[model samples]
Target: MVLEKLSKLIAEHKDVDPAGITLETTLESLGLDSLEVVEIIMEFEEETGVAIEVNEKLKTVGDVVKLIGECE
Candidate 1:
């Protein structure tokens, strides 16, 4: 459920196809810079009402999923 919502958010923000994103997809590969990533994270937090700590460890979609799981 988290992955689905996250993928949609990312796709909408980047104007990309959500179907192309997966757990293995890296943020860098999607052409997302650090500022864009932080904006996405902030938006996600607002939508989900979950606080996510931004860290250097976040590299892939899966990493974010894990972080969300831990936050929840």
Candidate 2:
């Protein structure tokens, strides 16, 4: 679900290698700039029914996965 969500998010932007992203890749590193955080959060809310407060503290993709798993 996470990868699907992430790939969809990236597809909304530019080309992304669905296989390129790994658990260790930070969303920021994938080019989801800080400004796109809100969009990503909203997508997660819709896709997983999770509400997240995005901030600099959310420093990695793992943080997002953990947060979504926590929602519920």
Candidate that would win on TM-score = 1
lDDT of 1 at 50: 96
Model 1 Cα lDDT, one tens digit per residue, 1-72: 889888998998899998899999999998888888888888999998999998888899899888888898
Candidates' C-alpha lDDT? 0.89, 0.69
lDDT of 1 at 11: 95
Error of 2 at 20 (Å): 1.2
Q: Backbone clashes per model, in order?
A: 0, 0
Alpha-carbon runs more than 4 Å astray in model 1:
none
Residues 17-55, candidate 2: write the lDDT tens digits.
Answer: 766666677877877777776677787688776677665
Identify the candidate with maximal lDDT: 1
